[model samples]
Structures are given as C-alpha cells and as structure tokens.
Target chain A: MHLYRYEENPLITPNDVPPHHDGFEVIGAFNAGVAKFQGEVLLLLRVAERPMSDDPNIVKAPVWNPETGKVDVYEFRKDDPRYDFSDPRVIKEAGAERFLYLTSLSYLRLARSQDGRRFTIDDRPFVYPSNELETFGIEDPRITYIDGTYYIYFSAVSPKGVGEAMVSTTDFRTVTHHGMIFAPENKDVLIFPEKINGKYYALHRPVPRSNGRPEVWIAESENLLHWGNHRFLFGLREGKWDSARIGGGAVPIKTEHGWLELYHGASDDHRYCMGAVLLDLNDPAKVIARSERPLVEPEADYEVNGFFGRVVFSCGALVDGDVVKMYYGAADTSMACVELKLDEILDSLVKV
Target chain B: MHLYRYEENPLITPNDVPPHHDGFEVIGAFNAGVAKFQGEVLLLLRVAERPMSDDPNIVKAPVWNPETGKVDVYEFRKDDPRYDFSDPRVIKEAGAERFLYLTSLSYLRLARSQDGRRFTIDDRPFVYPSNELETFGIEDPRITYIDGTYYIYFSAVSPKGVGEAMVSTTDFRTVTHHGMIFAPENKDVLIFPEKINGKYYALHRPVPRSNGRPEVWIAESENLLHWGNHRFLFGLREGKWDSARIGGGAVPIKTEHGWLELYHGASDDHRYCMGAVLLDLNDPAKVIARSERPLVEPEADYEVNGFFGRVVFSCGALVDGDVVKMYYGAADTSMACVELKLDEILDSLVKV
Candidate 1:
C-alpha cells in the first residue's frame, strides 16, 4: 500500500508542551486523538510529565493522593531490594504479587492546526487527573463527534487499575466530566460517532488476568453511561503481526464497504503497528474482514527510537474525500501524521 | 468471646458429593453459600472437579471451550519448561507476561439440611459453567434472600478474568442468570439482603493490577445490575491479624447497633481468617468499627490442611436470635459450621 509521510513529520514533541508543575519535565507529548472543528484540525495529545531527581541513587514517582487531594512524589532508593526499576516506565514492588507505580504521570493537552500539519498548542491542559481512580494519571484520548457534542474517551489509570472514562465539550473551552464508564483492567475504548440501531455502541479492550489476550470487544449502551450486552468482537491472529495483543484505534469511519476501523496491534516482541478491521455497518459486532498485514509499521526513525521504541500507535484519524489523515504517537514520545487513501486501505483488507 | 463448633464439624466433604463425570474426581466440596429456604437450610456448594490422569508426568487441566460448547481437558507435561505448575491451584505460563489455567473446574451444587449441621447432597449441579465468561468456572457463591427471591452472587472465572456474576431463584428448581454484575479482576461481591434508602448496596474486592491491595469497596445500585457511587470502605490494618488482603464474606447482618459483616483476611504468610466489620445501619459505606483480632482462625485440623492449607473462608450465615450460625469452607476442601454469639461478636469490634 502506498502512503505519504508529511515532510515536517514528528508534528509535536515534548519540548513543545510545557510541564504541569515547577519541578516536573515533559517526557512525552504524543498518542493524540484527531478531530476537526471550526475549520481547524485539533489533536488531543497525551502529555506525560515526571518529577526530576538530582541524586543518582534516588528515583521519584508522582502520585495523586486522594486523602490530601494533591499530587505527591514518592522517592525510592535505587539500592533498595524491595523496589524493582527494571522497567523504565514503572516502579514495581519485587514480590510474589506485583504492585505497580508509574514513573511519570500523563494528562491530555490540546493542539490545533489550520493547515493540518503545523500547530499551536494550548497553554493549559485539556483534561487533567482529579479523582482517586486517576491517582496515577490518564492516558490515550479518543474523540468522537456526534450531533453537536464532542465526546472524549480516555484511559483512567490508578492503583485501582486502568479503565476507560469519558468527558464532553462543545467549544473545547469548558469540560463536563463523566465518571468511569468501564471498570479496571480495561482501556483503548472508542465510541462510534453515531448510534447504531438506535443504541450507542462502543469498542473496548479488556485486559484479562488469568487467560486470554487483550482483544477488542463491543458493547451497546442506552444513555452512554451504563454499558452492557458485551460480546467479544475479535482477537489476535496466530503467527501474524497482531499475534500478541490488539486494541481499537480511531473512531471508526462509516463507508459503503463497512465500518472501517483503524486498530493498533503488537507483536510478541512488543512492536506496535496500526491495522484495519471492517465490521458490518448495521451490526457492529459482526466482523466482515480485517488486515492480513499492518497498514502502518514502525519503520521511521521517529517511530523506532523514543521513550518506548518500535511503536506506531494511533487513537484518532480524520477522513477528507478519499484521503485519510492519520495522527499517531511515535514510540510513545512524539506525535506524527501520515496520509493513506481510503480505497487503498479497503482493498488491503482480506475477506474473512 | 466463646464460640461453638458443630459436633459434625465438616458437614459436607468430597467423599459425600459424587464426581460430575467418569474420569473426574470431586477434589473439593466447599465454599458454600448458606440460606434458609422453606423449612430446610440450603447450602449452595462450590464443587470443584478435575479430570484424573494416571500418567505421573502429565497434569490435566479442565477448560470450558466456547467454540465446542463443551468442557475440554488439556494435558501438560510436568517436564515442560513453558508451563509452570508451582502453584497447586493454577498452571502459569513461564515467561514475561503470564497466562493462567485452572487445575480444576468448579461449579455450584446444592445440599439440603433439616438441621443446620447434617445435609444431603444434590445429584446435579445447582449452577455450572455456561458461557464464555465462565469458562474457567463459577465459585464462592454468596446468597442473599431479598423479599421472596434468593440472589446467588458468584465469582465467574475465565481467561477473560475473574468477575462477579449473579443468578436468582425463588424455588431451587430453576434460576435466572444476571450476566456479569462486576467486571474483571474483581470478586467476593456480597449484596445486602434488602435495599437501604431506596437503593441496593454491595461490597466487593477489586484486585488492582498496579498499586492498591485488594480491599473492601462499597457501591450502591438502583437495579442491582449496574453499580455506581463506588467508595473505598476499609482496608488491611498493618501488623494485625488481617493485614495482607481483605474481602467481603457472608452477607451483612443488620442489627440494632449497626450492620455486622464477616470478612476474610489473609496474612502476609497466606494464613486466612475471618474478622468482623461494623458499618452504619443506614449508610453501609460509613465504617462504625472492626475487629482488631480474628473471630475465626484456621486452628482445626480440617482448616489447617487440605487443597489450600490454613484457610477459613465464609460466604453466608444464618442469624437466629442472638446466635450467628456461620458456615465456612475449611482449607478449600470441606464445608464446616460454627456458631458465634451476636452480642459477643459485636462487643469485640474496636471503635473506629
């Protein structure tokens, strides 16, 4: 498949987004949800920030303490046998059953582009962590515009476990927060732009504990608050690019062929790539077809080397005419954009 | 405080309940939910059965296959490096992120008793694995008699994850399944017998992936199917008898002073015991008091040795006057009974 990468790729970096506090530094500004409003393209970016430590033996972790209602930093000695810092992204307690703490905290920030490439970032965060469920932080925002409202769905992370939560805003100035719509150990939730068969439908990835890999599951809701009628939509393919795990990406675009869904999948080696799946337009649960190979791989230098390497994850995309404008997070560090033809993606999908 | 153990301590054992099939053996007949129905005491017992293999090198795991709609046995070599069988209850995959499969499949069976001590076991399962969510099995039932219906809440285990599911019955003949009431990584959900302030309340333990330990959480529901208004009720007290992890046990018994709740807590050494928690009668979320020491410890031989040793877990109890007839699972192997005085138990709680 032929794809076009913008000349000035890596559209937004950590340096472009300011830290939330005085002692913190922005580590990542990526994994944005793309949307169009008021004749401008908007990217809701996930900005990750971490507290700085001067001592070589000490590492700091920021946590939202619900009791004191403030963000607190926990300092751990690198020499301590109890604290396992093997994973750069998290600080795990070394024991039989693991307890995890993020190395950095993440929240959503807004960026706008008139030309769909160059952009101006908002001074303040679009959405920040507030509740106990968001004690660790929030990550990965997906925007779905329906009627006159823009519904923003993101992953709420805490010691409680990662779950999906929603918020809504029309002008992007004020926000109305909706409490957690999904329980813990779940993320990558994307809502359909329009109701299907008179009910609101959503795609979610629930990470299993005992068995099963993370796969996309569909559920329908009445008021968009309480969700039910859960059915497993699809799972990982054997000996394929997405053999490890898979999740729902960009709000599925409606087409004559089917509901075109751009999704992210990982290999056994943790290499992330974007793939496509075609679901029946009327019945979103029915899978019509899916990609045999990745539509976008982590081949670019920006995508191959960053905070977390070998990843190209997209949460949102915008379709104009036959051109699909895809915004993805490169290596969990910086934001980048690419363009793919609608017909080319559709043709690439192997029939089930 | 003084307590009395029933003369026939283990009222039901694996020898009393027949295996589900030819090659299968009833490994466990415990963790039963006690209820007073008609003129007899009913025990909804979690009967665990596993396929027996004569080959000393092979371990068999029973799994409910969604595709075949049947229970299938998976055999793994004891010498296989990919499979880790160190944990007696579950088989874990050996590398990176682990996948788990149960050594035995569990389903609920019914046992009827004229007196609260001696019982007769049912021939068929009261409730068995039916859907994909319960592929692993259904376990640890907590029955609450509300109005005329008995609400049987259980932990539905699958590769998807362990979550709480509900089933209701007026007569023991048939049941109405209420899908999953709580999502994955959560279990030990106990619903109150009746509504308080026009809404139903339940206590649950959601095992966290990241930070928090498994603690008791209270949630209120309008329909009992969808829960909301979640609040952290209580957690483990450091250096106490109940320190490692805690979960709701028998349904809360409403009393004149408050609501008396029996909860199971595990120590750092994995010794399980039962403790008491007192909550506000009107608002169950409000903590009134809790036990500084355990009410029931694994001191008996049956409770100290079996499938899982040093465990005493209760799901249901019958409150007759000032006597609390508690039926508990001893070491995950047999059903046992004990009686505690309500006044003595209530006085043992240390005021919070």
Candidate 2:
C-alpha cells in the first residue's frame, strides 16, 4: 500500500526497439526481468513484433519454421470468424477446441542503464526460438545470479506448450543454452541464488492436469538436471483476490527473517496483481507469512490501458535493504518501476 | 461404395467389458485397431473408464499419477460454470480460453477374435500412458507389422499438445516403448512397414501454428528415431465431404498398380467419412490418384446416435487377395467391420 512510482515511468515501449524489417513493427516492449550485471542495471525486455498490413481485413503473425529453417508469416482474414482478436496481445482460435496464440512474435531484447532509470536497448534480439520446441518464441526471462554465473530461466513457447528453458552467461555477451530444464505444462520458474540444504531449490508453478488448483510449487535438485521432491508452497485462498492462481516472481532474497519472495496472483476474472510470501530459510516448502492483499494493482492509466488491460505482473525485483525496487509490466504492454519500503510490505503481511 | 456392412455390427460395447471396480463403469469400448497375429485376429480396443459417485452433481475422471504410483481422481461439480459438460464424452473448460478433457480415462485393451466377429477381450489393459509425454492417455493406435515386428503408433495426449508415440511388440505380450517419435502439435500418423529407397517413411499430420492449413505430411527416418525430410502429401478438399481434415487410416497396401491407402476425412461441420488415395510405389510422397467422393459415411443410425455423433474413423485394415477387411470406430463409441473389393476402391479413386 506504500509505494512510490517513478516520475519518468513507462521507461521502455515499442519505440525503443529497432525495426527488424520493412514490413514488421515492434508492438510491445515490456515484462522485463531485471538484474545488476557488470556494474550496470540490465532489463531483459520482451519485444513483440507484428507484420504491418495495409488490408483492413487481414492480420499477420510471424512464425518460425524449424523444418524449413526459415521464418514464415501467417495472414488471417478478419472476415473469417476462426480468429478471436479481442485482446490486442494474443489471438485466439474461435472454435470448439480453442488454441490461443500471441498475435505478435516475442523475443527477449537486452536494455542496460547506468542509473537504473534510463535504458539503452540493444538493436539485436537477445533470445529467440532456435528449435522446434521454441517455435512461438522465448519470453518472461527471470535472471538468477548464483556462484559468479548469471542463469536465465525463460518460458519457451511453441504450439506444444509453455515450459522453462535455461541459458547461462558468464559475461552477458556469451550465452549458452543448457537445454530444456523442464518439459511442457510448466512455467513461472524462479531459482534461488544459492543451494538450500545442499540442494538447489527453485519455485515453480505447475498446472495440474487433474482437479487440483494451479498454484506455486517448490522442487529440489542435486545436479539441476534431475529435479524431484516437489511440494506445494503457495495456493489459492478461496473467496479472496489472489484465489485463482499464484506464481513465483524474481529470485528469492534471503533476509534475517526468511527467504522473501514477491509473487503474482490472479483472480477468477484474470486480473493480475503483485503479492508477497515468505518461506522458511532452510525449507522453502514451509510458507511463513503471506500478504493479505495485493501490493501492486493496475491503478495508473498506463497500467489500465494497452495490449491486455488491467494487468500488473512482475518478473523480477531487487531488495536494497529497506527499499524494494520492482520492475513490472503495465497492462501487458509497457514497463514501469516502483519502489516500496520493506517494512511497509512486511507490516502488511498476515501470518499464514 | 460397393462395401457391405456386416449385419452383426457394433460387436463390442461398454457392457461387454469386465468392471475394473465396483464403483467405476466402462463408458466406451470403441476405436479398435485391427491386426492378425498368431493365427487369430486382434482388436486393440480403446476402453474408457470413469469413477462413479453417488452425488449427481459431480463428475470424476481418473488420472494415473507416476509420481505417487497411484490413480488420482479429479471431481468436478456441475454447478461450477467453469466446467462445460456439453459433449457427454469430454468435459470442456468454458472460459474465453478453453481446453477439452476426456471425462473418462482411456487405454488400449486387447480383444482376441478367432472368427474375427466374436471377441474375448482381456481383462487387463494392453497399453496406457507410462511417462510424462503421455500424461493424458494414448488413443487411436495403428499397428504396422514390419520384419516380424508389430509396431504400434498411437496419439499421445497431454496438456502440452497431441503428438504421436511409437512402441513395438514381438509377441503382443512384451511391449517396448520407443519413446515419443514425434513432437507435439501433430497426430494422425501412419508408418510404412518397410524401407523405401533405404529410408523408413511415414505419413504424418502437422498442425501449422501459422494459417497454412492442416494436411498430411510425409517424413523419412533412417533409424526410426530421428525423422526428417518432411513433405506435404494430401490436403483438404473444400466444399466437399472431406473438406476440413484428412488423416492416414491404415498401412498402405502394396497392389500391382501402386500403394493403395484408405484414409479418414472430416468436413467443417464435423461430419467424418472414409476415402482412399493411391501413391507411387517407389515414391510414396507422390500421389497417383485420390477419391472424388467418400467411400464410407455416417448414414446409419448406429453411426449417428452414439458418443460423438456423425463420425466414422478407421485405425487399421487388412488385405487378403482382392478383398479388404476394414475395421472402424463409429461415432467414436463403437466398432464395426466392412468388406470391399480392393479393385472397386481403386476404380472409385480418380486421377488427381
């Protein structure tokens, strides 16, 4: 409830990204994962690209074909009812069996800042789909710096499903893929900076195929290749705002109290908001305290309008002693920054 | 159109299957893939089962959990508008974004037939999902016997997407899993038994993420594990019975004229029918001819009145001299058999 928004908010938008081609335009530049690397603040910006078409009846989407080893295009006639273009960010196949696809192709683009306020974006894409498993494109990257290495875990999108894939960089310039860490039916994975109890721990959100609700889960790995010991961490609180789904945010920060985790939750209406949860320092499976209400909601006009309206989702955050600097995507379109006192958030928390 | 339907149709139903437990009931015993092995005809019947509850407002689906090595059940209340129980067989999530789930769990069951009409179905299941790739269940299996080995290719469903997986059985008792042969966003696979031009080829259907259209594709594999060289085979014929989607039916028969293949097609209105296509013997990718009209359609009451009405899908067929014995699932609920002169089908197919 006590947060200060930056004066020059909406730091990055479509105008910041360089054009890929003549017919394609950058539609969105938001949902960035933040980190402090090489004495500079880095934001892994999600850049969305869509084809510019003159025909009012047609909409085009970019496609990556691994079979042909080329990038192709899809043109959909607006006159045909097969497509649901209600949300500007994504297009849904309007049929008995639904297939929701993002209208524009999204890939990770790097933006760096000296003061963590103004950023200079790179012209080339940082991460894109290079294989069939990533045909849709890579998105929502969460950077975890552990043991002198920066590990980026991102959501690999394809027609198959969304899953978490890992890539590591020692110097931010040389990136190396570590293969798909988890298969389909997984997302919103955030790894801790160091191992807990001699085992690497990560917070994940697994969508249950059964009747169980979707919630945040914690898993441990000895080698980081084979993960097991999954336990539910945070769940939906019935008859509440964050009662539908909860996901892990950036890397968890260890404090004297416990491991502090800033998470995102959504209601049944799909309105996303930011919340906080505290886990036991030794056992993250044991949730200590949780926020009773949302920390950040869609209140500003920039957060109220654009691509997908009424959504304030955070991918990463930095805790500098008392001040919690958070970078969140506004309305699923643009990015903004906010800072809140750590005591104010902990005071707002309720014992769970 | 000269095919003769057997008088004793709908040979197997849910009532014929032995109960797995007292509380549960078999919902469907249909879509059997046919094969002749060890001097007897075999039917790989898809038996679907669901848990029964005293409460009329709830529906339950059984899930095999590999983690716990137990069958977990998902119970959904009818009052929850989030669940759509429109189609009796499948329960759909009815939000703006939708996903269809089978109300009952399905697995392949073996039914032995000495006379090819009356069958003694085995009490135990033949094949079900055992890994994460097949979390949903395997469906619509096609058996191709090559070099004294029976290969079973089936549709593997999960939350990720639908794809094809392969297995082999030397004695139909000990089956060997070959892992997932194809990735997600694909199905309707038919593998040719022997190698053509020193390569094992298969007919596949890859649903394009783009707007290109859904059509049958051909791929070649050197070791049957790594497949490549994909080529488009047959596509939909607009404004006709087979105007929407077409998939491979059985293994292509080696005829004197060429390789004759019987396939299944569906119209936009979900009207499923059967058709035939001829490919060059040396080059299976080259289509020599195609059926101008449907070979078998849902015209009878048995075909139009069961689960998933107005559907007739084939999984396997056999060729003995000039006669073709074909087994198909009607309305996705019950199986039936028909016989046709092979020459008659070839004559019906016109050069395209």
Candidate 3:
C-alpha cells in the first residue's frame, strides 16, 4: 500500500511551467511518466493550460489545423443551447450525435531529477498538438523501455475520440511517432517493459458502446501496429472504491510471483485512487491478485483542491529493490509523489 | 404540401403483419419504399414487432442471428441507470461511448397495391436481418430502380453502430445483399435511379462526432462497392421543425425545374415531419430551393397515437403525371398515404 508521502509532497505545480504565448495560463502540471534514461531520472509531465478570456460566457480550446500545421482557438459561448457545460473539464454539444470537448489544452513537458525528489523543469514543451487528429491535445504519457527503445505511450485526443499513440526515442530530444496505436474510444494504453512469450503485450481500455462498461483489456501484437487476440484483463468491482472504471498505470514490474502493475481506478462518484494488480508473467492477460482496497486516495489538501477535486492519478513509477517510487497527479491540478514498499503491495493484493 | 390524406389513413397496422412464432406481438408496420414492377405497385414496409413481457420493468428487443436464421430477444432491466429511455423509439446506453438501440424489431414486408391506396399485405417478411451487422434489425428502406434492378437501401443496426446496407433484386423474392455499403455511424442512404456524370450517386446521413451534427451527405461510386467523392448536401435548420436531424427520403424525382427530393426531418423536441428540397439536375449536391415549412406534421389521430407520437415520416413517393403519391409512416407506428400536386410543391419552395 502507498504509505509515506515525500516531505515536499507537491513536487510540481502550474507555476513551474511558463505561461502560454497566446496569453493563456498554465493550469496544472501532473501525471508524469517516471523514467531513468542515460544515467538521469526523467519525468514526462502532462501540463494543462487554458486560454485567458475577458468575457465570462466565452470558453476557448486549441484546435489543430491539418492543412497549415498550426493550432487555432475555437470559441463557444455559454448561453448557446448547442453546448452543455455541466462538467468543468468537459463541454458536450447538444444534437443527434454527442461530442464531448475538453475546455483546456494538455501537452507533455520534460523535467529531470537527481535524487528523484528535487526536480529541474524544462521551459519548452516536449510535445504539442500538430495534426487534425490531435486537435484536442496529447495527454497522460506512460514510458516503457523495450529492446533499448523507450516507447512513450500517450492518449491522443481529437474530435473522433481518445486514441493511443506512441513515439519512440533512443535519445530524449528526438522521437519518431508511430501514429495511432489504438483506435478511438480507447485510452490508458501501457506497454510492458519486455515481450511476453516472444510477443509484445499492451493494456488498454475500450469504452464499448454496448454494455457501457469501460474495462481494461490485454492485447498481443506481432508488429505492434497490428494487435489481436484481445483478452479481458479485469473489470470494476461493484460496491467498491473502484466501482466505475479502471486503467493500467506504469509498465508492469516483473517478479517471481507475477508482473506487478500499479493501476488507477475511479469510483462512481468520480473519486480516483491507485491499486495494484499482479498478472501472470508468462500469460500477462491472466489476472492473479487485485487490491481489495485503494493503495492511496485523496487525503491531503493538495490532493483535494483546485481544478477537479478528489483525485489521485498515477501515470508512471520507478522500481528500486523493495521500494516503488510513484509520480502521480493530485486533484488533476498538481503533481505529487508517494512511496510503496514492493513486498508490502504484493502482500496486500488479494483474490477478489 | 401534403394536400390530401388517404381515406384509409393507416393502410397497414399491427393487425396486418403476422406475430412472431414465439408468442410476440406485432407493434407496427410503417415507412414503406415504393416501386412499380410488372404492372403492379409494391410497398416494402418496415414492420416493427416485440415480445409481450409480463414484467413492466423488463424491456426486450429482438436480435437477429445470421447463423441460426432466427431472431432472439435481448433484455434490459428498467432499474439500471445505464439506460437513457427519454426517447420512446431509442434507448441510449450512457457512459464514455454512446449507443442508441431500438425498443422494437423491424423487418421489411411486401405489400402489393392495385389502386395505390389499398394495399394487400403479405404474411411473410420480404427482408429480415440476416447478419451480425444487422442484429438490431433493418429499417427505413428506400428503393431506387435502375437498369431493370431495384436497389433497396436501409439502415442496419447492431452493437457496433447504425450503418447503411443495400440489396439488389430483379425479382422481388430473390435479393442479393451487397454487405454494409456504408460503415457505422452512418445510415439513411438513398441511391439514385441513374448514373450522374458517368458515376453512381447516393444520398446518405453520417453522424459526425466532432460537430454533433447528423447531416445529409452525397457520395458517388464507380463500382458501387467502392464509394468516394463525398459532398455535404444539407444540414439542420435552427428554430425549425427539421432542426434536430435530417435524412434522405424517396429517390430524386427529375423535373424540368430540377431534381426534387422529399426528405424527413425531426426537431429537438422529437417532432418528425416531411420537407422538400430542390437540387440541380446535373449536380445533385447543389441545393437550389427548399421549403420554408414542413409539408406535413402529426395531424390525424392515426399519426398522433402510437409507439412514437408526433411523427409523420416518408420513405418513398411515386410520381404519376402531376400527382405525387407519398407513402409515409405515421407516429412511427403505422403506414399512410398522401398526395401533393407537383406544381403546388414547386411553387412553395423558397430560395432561402
């Protein structure tokens, strides 16, 4: 279970990132992917920014133009019946076909830490919206080092839906995008550190139109582009903290027992928490033991304040002997860290 | 504008179609496609049927099995909050991805008419859902006869989404399915009677998730299987009866003025009505003139009382001299007929 929080709990905040060139404010910098590349600990942080407007009725979002390769602002008025703004983070258009658009823009930023606690942030963004497919923005990156290649998997947002795209980088500066690895209505795609039984495996969440159940699924790939033999990994537990939905977090850590996976789960009331799931090493699709209780929920003021409240979302973590260092987003507004003893987490996992 | 209604307002009702072999009840038979073959007029009717359940809390929809060649029922509990039953015809599953399922089973039936007013209904269904793609049953068939072949276009529904499919037949009894002419999130397809500029053109409706608009689109085909060269035909008008959504009706009727299209439109309040649009003869995508008002709304008791109230939607219309005989569905429950003088409708169209 996640126990001790760092002395300086709020590791990263909105003020850490520079303001937008278009007079926008940095809303948050959280949900960072922890990685150790080239003898230095790296954090790929998801930085959310919102445009500044004089009128209270107007809301703006960054719209990507495929033709000119530029991001333009799309404005929607509050009084318009065509749009429904029930949620602060999302705006739903009213008509025959439903479309949900986020109010803010999210892009990845880089940060480096020597002690894995104190970090130095980069001024420039690591990734931003480029094509019409990424009209909304890229978000929530999870890095996996496989065959000397760091496969940075992130959610690609567009009008169609949230899909998973991967960019591979040997050196941190330059990366090659492999395009959309997962189709629309899918998110939280995480690749394993190594191949399982001579095949690449990934954990993804598909929001099925039927049943309305967004469950975590495992899929095997021969070329990584073409994925098949999908297997249902696990589903939400009724009358539990994770009764709504679940997604994979961080690359799976290999152990004698199984592949230890730290995952994020949300309750019906939208309270997010972390949990551990142990998968069979050979057959990663097989669910072994799952946490009966949340590893950590929003208990601190920083975890329950600003933007969306009552949230603790982990993007990635680093394994060091029996200790697991987790870098997570708090309240969807800022970044924080917590340490979990690897053996203690493995012991806490119980069969449901 | 829908000047006269047939004395027998509801030409075909639940009593007309045979009940399911499994003690189910026939709900309604409406939205018939019109065609004149072998000196006799025929109407392809979409007959909706459902199982008579003892429990009021349980809702059931008939699902067709391609392998078994039989219809099986799918049930949902009313107590589950996952269902959005606000719309009487469609029950939407709520969550990340939205899916709308019909409450009744619809199958096409053959009805022959001598006077075009009184129709003799057949006991057996002419066309039923025969594939996994059509598990939700076929609906809203529009017929276009070209080169001695009748192309029947209808909306096919399943767990995936609603799509457009077609069947070609020389003899009405024998039909050859072309298999999903248009992919999911699309329907209401009406093919043209002849090739336009050496290419086959079809009118379709695609629900774009980006804009939340379900607008009518025109697409051309070279081999009928491969479709391309798509053009936006028209969309919903604000503060109007057709403000919610619109779809193509009968095949384009060529006139000296232009090619006249009779289409169905629904308002946000779920009021369905018929409308007219005039398109350029050579370039069918170019909208020349449109009716400022709906041709007909729910007026008569037959069109006012049924499964879905306040609906008068047409699938096909036949032209004989200056009289346009329109066959339409009433209240989404029963079939009816109305006649309009060609000169009157043409004069009614405004350039706005």
Candidate 3: global Cα-lDDT? 0.80
Docking quality class, candidate 3? incorrect
Cα misplacement distance, residue A80 of candidate 2 (Å):
12
Best model per lDDT? 1
Better of 2 and 3 by DockQ: 3
True contacts kept of each: 0.24, 0.00, 0.04
lDDT of 3 by residue, B1-352 (tens): 4489989878888787787547688887888898999888899999888878999998776677778887777788887798876655667775434656677778899999888878898878888887766888889898999888998888877765566678889999899987666654566788878887887877877664434356777777655544534445788899988898898888889899888999989999888888899988898879999988988778899998898888898899999999999899998889899999999989999975
TM-score of each: 0.91, 0.61, 0.60
TM-score, chain B, each candidate: 0.98, 0.95, 0.95
Candidate topping TM-score: 1
Residue A46 lDDT in candidate 3: 92
Residue B208 CA error for candidate 2 (Å)? 12
| TM-score-best of 2 and 3 | 2
lDDT by residue (B94-128, candidate 1, tens digit) is 86345578999999999999988889999999898
Candidate 3 docking DockQ? 0.06
lDDT of 1 by residue, A163-190 (tens): 7888899999898987777766678998
What is the per-residue lDDT of model 3 for residues A1-352, given as tens digits with 9 covering 90 to 100?
4498998889888888886546788898988887898778899999888887999999777666677766677789998998877677777866433456778888888989888887889888887775555778889999998777788878777765566777888888888877666644567888888888998888887664433356677776655554444445788889988898899887788889999888999999999999989999899978899999999889899898878989899989888899888889999888899998999999999974
Clashing pairs in 1: A100-B210
Ranking by DockQ: 1, 3, 2
